[model samples]
Target chain A: MKKTLVIDGAPQNCALTRTPGGMRLLVGERSFDCALETLGDGRYRLRAGDVRRDVLLAQQGDQLWVHVDGRTHAIQRINPLDALAAGGRGGADSTLAPMPGTILTVQVKPGDAVKSGQILLTMESMKLEVTITAPHDGEIAEVLCAPGQSVPVKATLVRFAAKAEATP
Target chain B: MTPQPIRRLLVANRGEIAARILRTARARGITTAIVRHPDEEGGLAPRLADDCLTINGPTPVAAYLDVAEIVRVAREWGADAVHPGYGFLSENARLARALAEAGIRFVGPTPEVIELMGDKIRARNFVVERGFPVAPSAIEADDPATFAQRALAVGLPILIKPAAGGGGKGMRIVRDASVLEAELATARREGERYFGDGRLFVERYVERPRHIEVQVFGDSHGKVVHFGERECSVQRRFQKIIEETPSPVLTPEKRGAICEAAAGIARAAAYVGAGTVEFIYGAGGEFYFLEMNTRLQVEHPVTEMVTGFDLVAEQLRVCEGEALGYEQSEITAQGHSIELRICAEDPSQGFVPATGTIHLLREASGPGVRVDSGVHEGQRVGSDFDPLLSKVIVHGRDRREAIARARQALRDTALLGITTNTAYLDRVLAHPLFAAGDYSTAFLDEQAAALSGKDEPLPLDLLLAAAALSDRQMVDAATSVPAIYAAMGAWRN
Candidate 1:
């Protein structure tokens, strides 16, 4: 089975292939041998590499919430076909506005390459500044907003180009 | 006039403090009433109160700040005493006077003492007049142009503080006189905007000073006693985020002197109930009076943990005209206690206040761990009020044990569906400097890059696997319900 996993809106191609011993999991360019056991109450004991963690998991709509070692990571899984049709905006490659704010500065234009965690723009709300960052290494497909423009929460601010770099 | 025993008590506040006061009041066999704003109808404080009285106004803040409405509700509810728990109107002199006029006992000090200590300039002068050590300061002059001259005389690196400000609001630090005018104007505007008072005061800024405060209690019979100091130097933007009792830096001799000074000031003011005298302790062993909080402080739990005394209960007993049952010689510190404030903020994103419904809450509970929370599951948290959701207080035999306990307790606690500083606090506790207790007020600011920076990237494969497995479980659960399919088929038009 194959899908795209979006973490904080950055998507990566993921594939799960079953083997005699265990399941081989591939996310983007990384691969690992993993085994999962149900611990009940939305908890799963996952063993990958040297780590064996009891991960608390829950699903709310398209977002998957997982708690591990006091921190919760929220990710979304998207069908590959959906990503192709939406040109990456429908899946993990879209940057949605995190809060209602006015854009103070836009750092990237269309077709610009951005590294994961690079500041894409700055937004201001309630006297505090929030730096919108690129969630993954990708080229910008489109820029939907400009400086001084007011946007609501969840408004798509920037979309990443679908990765032709990943393989099945 | 002889004091009457309070039968029913009304807490004129909201959130954790109100809930804490309710606990003590109920334990003492006193019936309790809590005023609830419209936005906080389901807040934890109201749920804990015997009588939850609604004070309706045009807005939530207005209703909470309505003095006449609060007093009227207290009278109608047959509350003989009112406890203004630490935030809204906690130090408001008008509310104290109103309660007095209504023939009700206010759990805090008299309005005169509150007014005297509530104002920074007056408090400084009052303390100075009574031969207390105070930092050299200049009150804002009538002429705006002469403000620079007065500030220069006080010395460079001066703090621009609002006279009526208790929190760090409307405060500015001018490192040099070059930008004094510009900074002064900004501070004045902020003061006027936040507090109604634009009057400013300039004082010599103490660089990297440790914030130590002594908790004092007094009664109507003119007796005052002091609890040991609590060090609150772990600050960000001038607001304390972490506090611990028996300040790590204070020596035994200095501790005795600071505590005595706090008691002396309270006795001189004829203060009643609980109050805190804050001081800015310098590295060179010099300490100066900063200001006095005329009401119970937010970090009182640390003191309670170490002293084994219920501060709220003491306030009630004092209001009932009872003398403090113990003297200074009897007060003792058992062990180290630390309090970590759990705010509804996204620390990875500049600590911006996050607003959402609390979908899940699992408070940590074990030996020596106490959780004072204002929120519960399914409660809607808007941006209208303070972002403080709860507090995690842990006590241990020593600071090292307390730190370890706090780290473990914080890890066990979980508040989902809203971004919080829980993880950030965990990292701070693990930091070597913080663990060593060799840090100053500049700890957060100096260590910002290291503290606020992103953690090592989470493996993508793990995240992908979790998302996929969780999504599949959801599908399996939904399909197992055959009635849902029938409902779906009928819904198709």
Candidate 2:
């Protein structure tokens, strides 16, 4: 299966396939076949690939932990795309909606050059602020949505000009 | 359909519900695989499973709800089935169909059942078309004025619910016309954000309604059995916090009617495996079909305790294509059972899903106590998932015994690090309204202010000890000290 997910604002096409002992995920030419199990307490066990045998295991909405070879690693995720999604409207794939909320703040404008996953707008609904982020390292081509302006799902808020291809 | 019995199982969910499923899977002699997400503070699931897998993706869409990732591991690990405990993508007909297409037996109902029951508008239409009484509601409306007027026709204090997504998200209670526009907008936004569409509908917000849910099971052979009802009257923010079997409000006649109505609907859907039909019982004992959760419910343990059956095991049997071993008549309710959702939230923070590290822990115990937790004492509670740490279930010979045992059990429980509602739950279990079994959705909302205040005078002594004892220095020293030394370190530290 393949899905176009906006991660921190950048659109990544992720494709996953099943391999014995785990799942083989392909995202931008990187593949990981991870052993997956649901431990039942909202925790799952996943071992990525046999060679890179360092099992990197975690769950959704969790703070962050990685126990590789009996060593525990604590990490925190910086959700840039979430920030863009919080900022009211910009891109189809790059802009994040307000977690299904109403747009709250418009932070940036069109022609704004943003780093990967920079917050361009913010939306507030139910008192929860969701930031919409720049999908990639690019200049915003157009800003179509505004603060306090409600847009439905799949409503285009911004457009992104992905970095240009280089000839080798 | 019984091609082979599953050897290894991949559970596709997180939290207390996932922990509960692990118990049954572990008991059945199957190897369990889990996908650990970051920021779990190294949750309890790490220590329980045979082998663990971690995913880098953090959000529900990236992790648990990522069907492709889940299915890939199930196939790679040679697990025969994936049990979606509930919520997340449990009702996602596509996920169910994906597993089916992959030749892996997805535990629970077939994709057919999932689709039939998952489409809220369609399911409501199916039941209403079949003569079942459904609350009057409207679908998508182009104009907000037309929508609110239609909603008012249904009556005031109406509920603006997302027509697509269920499980209380994207739901708003518009008490009067004053806030209808704002509530509708929020509901639509939430609906679209959560469910990929913002379409919403409105319904009569029943007053003083008892939130009762019925459990139904269907076999490969055409047969459906009712597992009585679970009283989910005690709720917070429109979600069940505490659940009990043999609702105090139900008469024998009422119970039969509610259960029968559920069974009829399940039969209509050709429901297979374990499923729940939720209903709202009105003041005069009238019942309306609220919705059907197409997967295992969070409070299944309470039903299991009263029925003396394993729901996961039953799902497995149905997946194995065996006829249900028990009939509707054979099923009987036993002793009372109650479950308190021990969550990591400050009830003071409007139950804002709490996030922090767990410094110390004491799980409740004694006879008839079951604690299903996802994270351990040292783990951090992540903001990425539901804040439910564990479901503490207690069974007793009667409701009074259960209540008393629950109170005592809750009192003995100790959790330090981030604040929890343990003290608040303790007060709730002891409250006259709770003890008297007078429960409702509004029970907490009505008494929230008073409850917070009433708790102020009762236990300075215990809270002081708990607070001082929970301090970092004391806790740090206690982590190393012997029981006697720790007792002394209470002041020294």
Candidate 3:
């Protein structure tokens, strides 16, 4: 089976072929023979050549949360179009993505006035919904991203314009 | 007069400390019970105890702090003694009094001593009156103006703190006199919000001082012994993240003086049971009494690793009116120990608390490594209580070997599900300043950028391979009963 996994916002194609003697795996720029064994309860013992690692696996929707050693990374399997569709929507005077994830909801629109700390949009990263808020009270110059859109890190989701002072 | 033997111990706390107390209590053949918040219904503490009692409240941690409920439960359950494992009601005078009234021994100091030392202002004054040095401080009630004037004499770089609380809550450092009033008001507001006590005090902030504390234990028979000291200078937001014994700074003479002062203060309070005297040692060896934690401390294991004395056992024996048979001269310290607090926090995101199921955990073992963890695999870590997941302590012949062992232990330790500060701790241990043992309380703050920043390039390929290995579907692929069986379509052969 062939798969493309988005790791740290970059896509890596992986191909796996089952063999009587463990399994043959091909990753970007490298290929190796590895045997995967289940220790039951979402844990795996992966032996790639002489290197062995204990990994904990959990699936949250389409994303795979992998924990190797002490570090955890949320990797999602995405197609080429989905990867291409995910673009940088960030710009100066806009809310940039704190992490690479799908925009779950956009709460603001072009020309909408927002107060400081107002929730402008929400993005889902690693199965956690993070609310993107307005840095300061301002009018929305443009809505750069929509719900269900995948965005990379530093992608601007919404642009803001400074509120005009009232002339007394 | 002989004291009542503690046949049953009811730990009025939660998490790792509770589990830790249970270990010692059970070893003594004492029946143990743990009071847990309903949210922590099946947490490690309850699972480790002989009996688990639920205390419901508005929040999970609140149940642990419910003095009336705790005392009532202890009496109803026929507990001989109540152990308020650090935090919660650990230093609460009312709980001690309540337990006493209920005819239960409180495994800590008396109510009067707790009340005296629980208040930061009162404790400082009492210690200073007893000839123990304390930081220059001024206490005021809702009068920032008066505090502002007094603080000017106390000098700039003063800390505006709540007079009745600990844990650095409602504490602010004033570098400029102009902002002292605002900071004082803010501190007072925070104090009132958190502790419901608006009383505030200003003290001369000891900039970059090493936090060296001596563990002093007193028996009911008027015997007190000091267990060296633990240097807890590596702190973040006033919470200690790393602690080690034989503070890299303290000279032999200074260590003796601080330990003696701790024992002297404990004796002066007529303090019984386990207590810790915290001191802020200045760069020039001048030290001031910080406060006395009148119960077991979170980092007591570091002292235990060096002193080879089980402090919880001592607390139990002291409350049972047993005399400490060993003298101060007999107490010995061997090897060096260091502890890293593994918290369930996201370091990259300003150390925000993260809650979720701990998917997998591989605790570090082997020589010179010890892990005191209250969490286990598949346990759901809720955001209702302290975020401290566990502690990794390592001991070696010296500080260098201890550091090396700690680094290895932290590297070997793994808690895969839910975010943690383990990687961040590894980085801190690897820092040159940390390796040189030349860090102060400001170490975390001063080196925040270097510690948190991605100093090394991301190993994307390795991560991808690991992720692929951890794919849940990979289990099916690996465990499938051979491709030939699926192709044969349920053949009897």
Candidate 4:
């Protein structure tokens, strides 16, 4: 089976085949005979060649957090449907709340043209103020939240309409 | 005054400090009560305490900072003494005075001492008046009209700071005179915003200065002793990230001078309980009194490890009217200890605070290794409090062994599901300059590029295999066989 996973913000193609006592894993041009022993509680012992290391794993939706050695690598399996929706809407569609916070102010209304990196909203979380900015030059399609309204992580605060193509 | 044992203690704080104090209190056979905000109901501190009370405020941070609420809870809980661990109301004279008014012992210095040393300008003046070394500076409160002129006269490259500021907040270092006024205004504004006190002071900025502080304890019986010195020069944005005892740079002679100066200042103030006297050591070996912290410090464990003293226990004894019970000659330290602050921050991202649920936590432990952590597995780590999650402290016969052990401990630690500075700190420990103990307060800032290097790419196949095999859907798809094949069963055999 083939799968596309985003590792640390970069996408990679992977192939996996079940074999006797283990699995054959391929990434790019490299292959590995991988066997995993579940240690329970988000922990696994991975054996690949001469390397043997304990890996801890946790998942929230498609997002997976894997701890190997001393660092935790963030991985997410890309869903084709979600990618299609995002591509159809635009390169990057909306500004989502980075974390759970209360909206301090909204900078624009629907139909307002915004330049890339323009501040869209100001928010307060954990006593620190954060600013949400436009990812690309586009028109604001909708404002989903108001000042003083609390928001959860990943809550869409502002939606952007597809930018008009540049005139020749 | 004779010694009076405390029967019940109220820990008016949260996080690792609270847990640290509770451990000593329990060992000393004192009943303990802890305060927690509603948001921190599942925190580790409350779980360790004998009784927990929920304190309320407009926000979680406010709840912890609410002096009145903390005092009320302490009184209602029938706590005979209150230990304001550090930060929040730990240095608040109002809390100490209020507790004293209620006939409850405040496990710190008297309110007068707190108020005096809490203000930077007052503390500096006090030190100077008592023949202690202090850097030259100008105070806005002293003469607001001529403050700018006086600050410029002090010399070029002055640091404009709020008298009531700390933790690197509201400080502006002006190297050029042309922008001094603008930076001063900005500093004053920040001072007002962050500390709510516009009182500003300016001092000569010491280039490549090392921060060395002495841990001092005093009692009402008029006794003071020093626990050597701690070199906390490894800092980011004026906050110490790594701290150690017997500052590697200080020779025995210089060490004696600094420690004696620290003890002199504390004894003059008649300081009681545990306090730290911070000094700014210049390259020329001249040291100036920076300020005095009138409560326990975050890096006190390093001192405890080397000196074999329980600072919290000593604080309890001092507040209970007990003498230090030792002379200056009796206090001695051996070996070297290092402490690295494990914070929930992303060093690559300008050290901005990170928040997430701690899905998995494996604290470093072994011989000569200790982990003081306030976080537990499955607990949500939010920005409502300080980003410090824990401290990994290691001790060795010497500095080299301590560094090696600290690096190993960092590798041994695994705090998954959130971004932390564990890896960044490991890189710092690996730096040659750090290994040689040849660094100053600007170590992190100076070594930015070196420390921020991207980790060597690991085998992608292994990472992907781990991710894929652990994934439920992927594993099921890989393991499942066709229905026809299953139906065939063992027919082929």
The top-ranked prediction according to lDDT is 4
lDDT string, candidate 3, B411-438, tens digits: 7777766778887898988899998889
lDDT of 4 by residue, A34-99 (tens): 888988877789877568888887777777777787777778886556777767755537888876
Per-model lDDT? 0.81, 0.70, 0.81, 0.85
Which regions of candidate 4 deviate over 4 angstroms? Answer: A90-168, B178-182, B481-493
User: By DockQ thresholds, what CAPRI class is model 2?
Assistant: incorrect
Q: Pairing residues by index, what is the TM-score of model 4?
A: 0.91
Highest DockQ scorer: 4
- Residue A131, model 4: Cα distance from true site in angstroms: 6.9
**Residue range A70-158, candidate 3, lDDT tens digits:** 56666776545555666543333778987656687789898888899999998754323477999988899988899877676577788
Q: In model 1, what is chain B's TM-score?
A: 0.93
TM-score of 1: 0.83
True contacts preserved, each candidate?
Answer: 0.17, 0.00, 0.14, 0.32
Predictions ranked by TM-score, top down?
A: 4, 1, 3, 2
lDDT of 4 by residue, B158-204 (tens): 98989997767777788888998888887777677666798899999
User: After superposition, which runs of candidate 3 have C-alpha atoms over 4 Å from their true positions?
Assistant: A1-133, A139-168, B142-144, B469-493
What's the distance in Å from true for residue B267, model 2?
0.6
Ranking the candidates on lDDT from highest down gives: 4, 1, 3, 2
Q: Candidate 4, DockQ to 2 decimals?
A: 0.38
The structural similarity of chain B in model 4 to the true chain B, as TM-score, is: 0.96
